[model samples]
Target: MIFSLPVQQEPKKYAPVRTLMLYLTEECNLRCTYCFVKKEPKYMSRETALRTLDWVLQRNVSGGEYKVLVNFFGGEPFLAVDLMQEVVDYGRLERPNLYKTFKFSATTNGTLANERVERVVREGQLALMVSMDGGAQANRLRPMVSGRESYSLVRKNLPRLAEWARLCTARVTFTPDNLELLKNVRDVLNVAPVGVALCPVVEADWAGHEQALEDAYAELGEWFAAEVRAGRRPPLEVTWELLRDYQQRLICKRRPQKACPLGESLMAVDSQGNVLPCHRFLHRPQQRLGTVEASELPDERWLYAHLKRAEIPDCETCVARTVCGGGCRAVALDGGYGLNEVHPYHCLLMQAHMRLVARLYAELRHDLNFWSGLAQVPTDTLNQELYQLGS
Candidate 1:
C-alpha cells in the first residue's frame, strides 16, 4: 500500500503569545539524574508570583488574545502551592473578565500531592503532569531527596491524582540506561489513561545506541499496532504524535512552521522574575530575551530569525521535517549544534518512529472497516472532510 503526500500550503503568520510558564521555585523533592536545572533553595515570592500573573494577564487583555495557558513549573510546583493558589484566586477575583481566559497546568514528581492539591485540581482549576519513567527499575534515576526509590511513592498517588485532576499526563524520560524499560511504558499508561510522553535524554552521548533505540521503538510500534487492532485505545505519545501528523497531512494538507512554542507563542519566567524563551533555557543567561519588568512582549522578529524551522538548512530537504518540526531547539543547542540542526540521535529516533508509524498506518488503511472504526468521527463525515481538504 502506498500513501500519497498532500500538497504543502504556504506558512501561516506566527500566532500571538498566549502561553506563560511560571517556574514557581527551584526547590524539589526528587533528585532526578538527568535534571537540566541545577536545583537551588530559591523559591518564588508571593509578590513576584502576583507580578508575573499580572504581566501575563495584561498582555492577553491588551493584545486581544482569546485564551492564556498558565503553566506552573518548578523543581516541583507543589512545593509552592500557597503561591499557586493565591495567583489563581487573584485571577478569579481581580481579573474577572480574564478569569475564564486563564487555564492552569503543572508538572510535578507527584511526591507532595495531597488533599489541598486534589481540591484545586478537582475544581477544574489545574491540570497536573506527573513524572514517572516506566516501572520501578527504570525510575531509579529519579530518586527522592534522601536517595531512596520514588516509584512506589509516585505510584501510590496515581489513583488519587487521576481522580482529582480534570486532566492528567505522565512523562517518561528514556535515557540510555532505561532503554530496556520502553516495554514497561504500558505500566505507566495503565495508571493514567491520558497518556505518557516519551522523551529522550538530552545532552548525553547517544552515538552507539542508535540500533538499540531503533529496536526499542520498533517493539513499541508493534505493541501500539496490536492495541489499535484489538480496538483498544492505548495512550502512547509517540504513536499519537505520528497519527496527528498523518491526519494533518492527509486531511488538512497543512504543516506547522515551528517545532515548539518557545520564543513564538510561549515564554517562561523564573523565580526572580527573569524571562527566558522557554523553561529549557532557564539557566542559560544568553538566551534571556528580557525580564518581565523590562518588556511585556517578546522580540518576535529576533525569535523568528533565530528559531524558525525554515531557517534550518537541513530541515528544508528532509522528508520528515514537517512532522518532527526539526526536533527540539534546546536539545540542539545543548548538543553544541545550531538551532537549525537536530541532534543526530534525535534524527535517528525520529526516522525510526516515522517508518514504524507509516507501516502501521499502511496496514490499517488496507482494512476499510478497521480504519473507519479507529477514530470517533463517522467514516462518511471523515471522507467528506478529506475530500473538501483536497479540493
Candidate 2:
C-alpha cells in the first residue's frame, strides 16, 4: 500500500535516452510575462525541420535505446502544426526500417487548437500540454501580443485539446505573484479532464517568499493526499514526480544525477536550426551547441561543469542535493545566480516537497481501504509500480 517495491539485490537501473525538442517557430500569439523566448518572426523551414529530424534519427545517441522522444516546442507550437504534421509523417515513414519509434509531444499556449492541430494530435498520438495559469493570473501574466486577455480563448480550447489527446495536461507556471497554487489547479481541472503540472516560476527572484511558496506547496500536498485517500488519482504533476523519484531512489539505492539534463541527455534545436542545451537557452547565442548540419553533437563538458550537483561546492553539502539535483540550470542563471547554483528558495521548496511526499506515502501505506480503492483509480504509473512491487 505504501507503493514501493521491496529493495532488490540486483536493482533495475532506469536510464532514459535522449529527448529532442524541435523549436518549431519563434512566433507566438500570447506574450507571457515570464516567457524566456525572444519573440521574433523566425520560423523553421520545412527543409530545416525534416533535416534536423533526419540528423537525430540517424544517430544512436549514447547507443542502447531504439526509441527517441521528439517534442514540439515553441513560442507556441500549434502555430506551426502544419510543419509538425510534416515532421511526424516523415519520422513515421522513415523510422520503420531504421528500427526506431518516434514518440511525439508538444507544449502550446492553448489558444490555437484548430482541426489541423487536432488531426496531427490524433494521428501521431502526440501528448499535448497547454500552458495556462488559470483565472485572472492567466490574463494578467499571459496577455495576448495585442494586450487583450487570453484566458477566455485558452479556457474555451481546453475541452477540444483534451478530446484530441488523452494525455493532455495544463502546465501552470506558478510565480510568487500568483501564490494560490491549489486554486489555480482546481480551476484548470474544472475546465478539462487534463492533468495539471504546476511548474514553479524559478526565473523570478523568490528570496523573501520562501515560506509563502513552501506553505502553498504544503497546502497542495494536503489536498493531494486527501484525493488519494478518497480513491481519486489527483492529476498533480509535481507531487507525482516527487513520488516517482523517491520510488526510484528506494528501488535502485542510487542517488539521482542532475535534475535538469539539458546539455547532457536532452537537447533542443531552434527555428534557425542551431542546437542548444534546451528551449530555455533559445535566443542566447553563447549557449548554442552547434547546428543540425554538423554530424557530431558539440561536447557538453562545459555544461556538466556546472550542471552536476556533486561538482557544485555548495550543493555537495546541501541536504537536498540528491533530490534537487542542483535545481534547474536555466532557472538558477536566469534568477541572477551562478551556473550550477540553486536559488535559496528552491532549496527550501525541495526539502518541503520531499517531506510532504514522504508523509503521504507513509499515511497511505497502512490504509487498507485506500489500497483497495486504488483498484478503480486511474494513475500515470501507480498500477505499473504496484504490480512491480507485488512481484
Candidate 3:
C-alpha cells in the first residue's frame, strides 16, 4: 500500500543541513538480535560513494555553511574500507577548500579495528563510536556469525582502536535481560576514560518491565553523580544531552523550537544513495525522500511532518515535552505507531531520566568541589540556572 504524503503545513525556519551520514554497506560480521537493518552482502561502489560526497559538498556550499560533517555508517563501515578511503582522498584533492571543511566519524561493531581502518581514522580525525553492550552476558545478544560471544574480541581491540581515533565512545543498547547491568556499566564495558552512552532496545516486549527500567535509570543517575564526585566526566551522551537541554530551559525561560536537528539540518543516505530521514530509517523504502542525484530535497513538510513536537498529541501537555522531543521517530514508526506518537515504555523511561538529570544537576550546583574538573557544563552557569529553576 502506498502511504499518502503528509499534507503541507506552515513552514517553520530551522538550521540548514550541515551533517550527512552515508551507509557504506549493509554487511555485518556480528548478528545482533535487535539490529534494525536487514543485513546483506551489498557494498557501496566508489562511484556512488563519491557522488554522495559531492552532493553533500554542494549542499553545504549552497546552504552557506563552510563546515560539514560526513559520517561513514553501515552494517560495518570497516567492511567497505576501500570505498571510505577513496571518498576521503577525493575530498582532500578535488575540493581542497571544502576538504578541510569536512569532519568525519563512524559507528562500527568494534571487531574489525585493524591497522587499515585505524590509518583512515587517524588521517581523517574521525570520532568513532563502538557498539558494546555491557558485560559478556549482556553482550550475548550480539554474537559473531559462528554463534560465539564477541565481548572478549571487542574489549581487546577497544584500547588500540581508541589510540588512533580522535575520540572513541561506546554505544550500549539495554534490553530487559541486561537492565541490571546499568549499575555496573563502566566495569562491564571497560572504557571508563572513553565514556559510554545508552539506548533502549527498540520494539522490545516491554510488558512487566517498566519498573525495572525505571530502577535501572535511577541507578544510572547515581552512577553519574558518583562520576562527578570523582572528577571524571564520562560523556554519557543521552543523559548529557538531556541535562544540557533542561538547563537551557531554566536559563532561557522558554522551550526550544525543535527537538533535534534530524530532518531540518541533518539527513542520512543509504548505500544505494537513497536519502532517508535518518540512519535508523534505512531499508524503509516508504520513507525515502529522493536520491543523491536529485537536485531538490523532498518538501520540508513531508520530511518533517512527524518530527515536530507540536504534532504529537501527548506532547501538547507533557511537562518534559521540550526536552524529550517525543523520543525517537524510528522507534515510534517500528512499533506500528505514528511518528508523532511515542512508545509508552519510552515515555516512562524519559520521564524518569529527566527527573534524575534535574536532581543530579541540583546536587552538583550545591557543591562546587564536585564541579572541579568536569567539563560537561560550566559551574557558574549551572549555579545560576539552578537558582532560576528554584525560583
Candidate 4:
C-alpha cells in the first residue's frame, strides 16, 4: 500500500540522535588485523579526564532532553581500568545529575576483562560490546597481543562478560573471508549475548556484493528473525532500519533536512580531553573538532557548523542526505581515503538496510496507529520521518 503523507504531517519524530564515545585511552593490547581505530599508547591525563566530564555536565545549562551516553573505548578500555573507575565513580559523587539520563557502555577485545572489571560493569551497569569475527579464522584476523586469537579468549571470558553487562553483544567483523559464516559464527560462539549485532564489514579490502555476503544476509536475517519469533527478545541493532528511511526518501522523492548530530546529544572526548565529532570521526587529523582541553564544550554556534558541514561532497544531491548525514564521518574518511569518494559500501549496505527497513516500515505503517510518541517508537523509524522535514 502506498504510504500517503497524512493530512496533518506527523511531526518529525526521531532525529538521528548522537551518542558520545569517551576515549579513555588509545593504547590497545589486541592486534586485530582489522582494527578500525588507529592504535597508539596515548592515554588520557587525569586533568584531561576531569575536564572532559565537566564539559558533559555543563549541557544541563542548555536545559534540554538528551540521552547522555558515555562509551569507554581504548586499545582496550579495561587497560585503563583505574582511570575508568575513577571517572565514573567520581562523576556520580561530584555531579549528581549530569544529563537527563546517564547511560554507559564499552566495546572491547575482552582480553583485559577480569573479575574486578566484571564487578565494575555490574555496579556501573555498562553495556558490553565485545568483538569476535568468527571462530579461528576470525581470530587470525583479530589476534591478541599475547599471540592469542580473540575468538577462544573472548568465548572463554563471555560467561563472566554476559553476567556483567545489562546487555551484551559480540561485535563481529564481516570481511569477505568470513562473511558467509555469519550464522555459523553465531552458532559456534553461541553465548547468550544481549543480542548479536550484524555489522557490514568495511575496510580498504572490502569487496562488493560477494555471493557470501548475499548468502550471509539471507541466513543472518532468518537467524535473527527466528530468535525473535521464538520469543527471545534479544536486541540486535541493525542499520537496515536507517537504510529504509534512506530508501523512502528516495522512493517518495522527498528531501531530508535533519542534520548530523555529532556535537549535540553526543560528544567524543578522546583520552586527552580532545573533543571530536564522535568515536568513528576521532582518528583522522582533519576531523578533530577541538581538544576539550583547549575549550569548554563547543558553543551551539560552533556545533551547528560541525553538525551542518557538508563534509562529504557526494551528499549534496542525495534524497536521504539529511538523516543519513553522509553516513558516519570517520567511515567516509577511512574508506574513502584516496580519491576519497563516498564509500561504495554505503550503497551496498544502504541497499541491504533499505531492503530491511522498507519491509519493517511496511509492517509498521500497517500498524501505524499502534505506534505513537517519539520516546515510544523505535529510533530508526523516527529518524526517517524527521529527515523528511529536514529537522
Candidate 5:
C-alpha cells in the first residue's frame, strides 16, 4: 500500500516534539573499551542545568505536548547526583505552574548507588537504565579507571538499585567477541527484574561472527516465544519496540517515521551545553545542533535530508522498513559514511531481529484473545507490566 502525503504539507504526527537529554557530566569511574563518550573533567553546572531546563520548558509553554521527558545522561550520571536532584526538584516546582507534565530519568553505569544517589532517585521517582554487559563480559569490557573489575560492585548494588528507581532497565551492548545473548540475558535478568534492551555494537566489525550472531539471536527469539507462550512476561524491551512499529505500519496502517528521533522529538545536551542530536554524536563537533544559551534555532538540515525512508534508495523497498526505519544515524556516521548512509551490518542485524519479531508475533497471532489484549496494551503500561513481572 502506498502511504501518500500532500505535496507541501508535513503531517502533524511527524512534527518535531519534546524530549530533552541532559548530559550531566563527561566524567566516568569506568572506561569501557568501546564507549563513544569522550571522557573529560567537564560537568554540567547547576547554573547551566537550570538554564537548559528553562530553555526546554519555554519551548513547551505554548505547545500541545503533554509530557516532556528530561533524561539525565553522562559518562556516569551518578557522578553528578547533586545536579540531577537539583534539576528534578526545580522541574517539579516549575513545570506544574506552566501546566506541562515533566518526567525525569537517568542512564548510569550502576556502580555508584550510594546513599545520596539512592535518596535522590527514590524521592525524585527517577527511571533508571544501567549499562551492564552481563557478568564476566562486563568486567572484561567495562573496568574502573584503576583497571579493577567492576562486575562485583555493580552486582552487589543490584538489590538497592532495583528499589531506588521508579523503574529500572538493563541496557546490554554486545559486540562480535561477546555474542552470548542467552547467557547475557539470563545473567542480567536473574540479578534484577529490570527490563532489558539487547543492543548490538553496530560499529564493531563482525567479519567472522555474522552467522554466530544470527544464531544467538534466533536462540533468544525461541526462548522469548516460549516464555510468552507459558504466560510469563519476559522483559525483552527490544521486542516491544519492534512489535509497536510493526503494528503501527502493517496492522494500524500508519506511515513510517524516522526510527531514531534524534533531531526531532528527541535531542541531547552535552556537559558543555552544546546541543546534539543524541549523546552518540558528542565527539563529532560538526554535528552540534545548537547550544542551550544560544539565541539561534538548532540546525536540523542533516536530519531533514534523511527523515523519510523514501529518501534512501536502499530502504525504499526493504521488507523491514516499517520497523527498522532507515537504521541508526550514529552508526552510519561512526562507520565513516555520509549522514544518510546506513552501515551494511546494521541492516543485517535489523533484518535478523525482524525475523525474531515475526516468530514471536506468529506464536500469539492465531489466538484472537491473546493478540487483541496485547495489541491494545499502551507503551507505558506494557513497560510497567514487564517491570512487575521481572521484579
Candidate 6:
C-alpha cells in the first residue's frame, strides 16, 4: 500500500519520479575498481551546482507536482562539500518557486565524515548512504592517498560518522566473499552505524557466484524475516521488504509501455556538469544530455528521446522493456552488453534476492497472501534495480 504502483496506471505515461542525483565531485581520493564514474577531484562549479538545482524547480513546473529529491554523490562527495552546501542553501531558498517539495540526500565514503560535514547535512536535513566494504579485507580495496591505511582512518572516522547518522536516515554496506569478513564484523551489528547490511558482489562477469549469493541471502533473509516477525529486526544491506514489490511491478511482463521514472524526472548530473540518463552510467560521456550549462535542469535531450523511442529495437517488442526502459543505457553501453540479445545479467543478483524473498514470501504467505501470483515464478530475471544498484 505504501507504493504508488498498485494504483491503476496508464500504459503511456509511467516514468514519474520524485528524485534527482547530483555529482558534486567526480574526484575520489580512493581508487575503487568498481567505480562507475571513474572520476577524481574535479568538482562542480558553484554556478553549475546552483543552476542544476534551479533547473529542477523549473522541471517541476514544466513537468508536474512531484517530490524532487537531490542526492549528493561524488567521486567522494565530501571533497565537494562547499558545492554540496551551496545546492542545499539554494534549494531551500528557491523551493517556494518550485512545483513541489525539494529534499536532499548523499552517497559518500565515510573518510570525510566530521562535525562540519555533519552540520551541513543536519542543517539541510539530508538523508545519507555511506559506503564501507566489509570489516577490513573489503576495506583494503579502497586505499587512501600515499598508500596509507584506510581501515584505521575509517575506524577513527566511524564514531563521527555514527553521530551524523544518528541525526538522519543512513545505511552501511558489507560486500562479503568469505567467512573472514563475516566473523570480523561481529561488533558491527551492535555499533550505532545507522543500519547495517551486506552488498552482493556484482562486478563478476560470469554470474557464476549467484548460487552462493542467493544461498547466503536465503539464510540471511530467513533470519532477518524471523526477527522482524517477532518484532525484532536485524537490518540487512538494503531493506528488501521495502523494494520487493517495486521490483515485482517492474519485471511484470503484463504491464504496458511506460517511461522510466528516472528517465522522465530523476536526472543525474556528472562531475563535468554533463547530465546523464542515470548515475549508474556516468562513464559513458557520449550519452550525455548536454552540460548543465545547457539547461540547468532536465530536458528532452536526444538521449532522453532515444530512450523512449518506440522503434528502439530492444524496448518496443520487449514485454518488461518499458518498465525497465531498454535497460540502463550506460550499463548497456559501458559493459558492451547486448541489448535485447541478452537478458540483462544484472537481474541475476536481484533475482537471487527475489528468490530469497519468494521463499520468505511463501513462508509468510499463509498470513500474507498478497503475492500469491508470484508463487509459480521459476526464474530470477525479475529485477532491474540490481543492475542500476551495481552500475
- List lDDT for all candidates, in order: 0.68, 0.70, 0.69, 0.57, 0.72, 0.55
lDDT of 6 by residue, 1-391 (tens): 0111222432233243456678887788777555566665578888778777655554445455556677788778878887777777777763333345667777777778766688887777766665655556655567776566576566566566666642222233334344233333334555444554445444446345556665566566656566656655454434443245545664673433432444665678876678676787577655566665663434445545455422244444543332333334444555665322223554554455555655665566553333333332223221222212323
Model 4, 155-264: lDDT tens digits are 67777787788766666666666675565755534655445555555553546555556666666566545544454433444433354444456578655443345555
How high is the lDDT of residue 231 in model 5? 67
State every prediction's TM-score relative to the real structure. Answer: 0.85, 0.84, 0.86, 0.75, 0.87, 0.74
Residue-level lDDT of model 1, residues 317-386, one tens digit each, is 6556557766677778887888777777667666766777677777776654445444533233211111
What are the runs in model 5 whose C-alpha is more than 4 Å off?
1-17, 95-97, 252-255, 298-312, 367-378, 381-391
lDDT of 5 by residue, 1-391 (tens): 1112234543233333366778899899999887877689889988888888766755544456667677788788889998888888887774334556667778788899888998889888888877777787668789899999998888878768878888888878788877885445877878888778777877788877768877888888777766667767677776766776676677666545655566766778889888787767888888787788874455766566655442356666665777665666776878877666678887777777887777767677665543644654446632432221111
Give the Å shift of residue 19 in candidate 6: 2.1
Off by over 4 Å in 1: 1-15, 94-100, 250-255, 295-301, 310-319, 366-391
When summed lDDT is taken over every stretch of 10 residues in candidate 5, the lowest stretch is 382-391
What tens-digit string does per-residue lDDT give for candidate 3 at 1-391? 1111123423233344566778899999989888887889888878888887676655554356655667788888999987888877766554433432666777888898777898898888877777777778856789898998898888887887778777677777777888866777777446535656676775778788878877887888887788777767655756766677776778776765544456755688888888887777886788887888775676546875656562356666765765765566777788888866677767766676777777888888665544443344434321211111100
Off by over 4 Å in 3: 1-15, 94-100, 188-192, 298-301, 304-307, 310-319, 369-391
Candidate 4 Cα errors over 4 Å, as ranges: 1-18, 94-101, 225-235, 239-260, 295-303, 306-325, 336-341, 356-391
Arrange candidates, best lDDT first.
Answer: 5, 2, 3, 1, 4, 6
For residue 378, what is the lDDT in candidate 3? Answer: 34
Error of 3 at 13 (Å): 13
Best by TM-score: 5
Per-model root-mean-square deviation over C-alphas: 9.4, 8.5, 7.7, 9.6, 7.1, 8.2
Summed over model 3, clashes come to 0
Please estimate how well model 1 matches the true structure, expressed as its whole-model Cα lDDT. 0.68
Q: How accurate is candidate 3 locally (lDDT)?
A: 0.69
- Candidate 5 local distance difference test against the native: 0.72
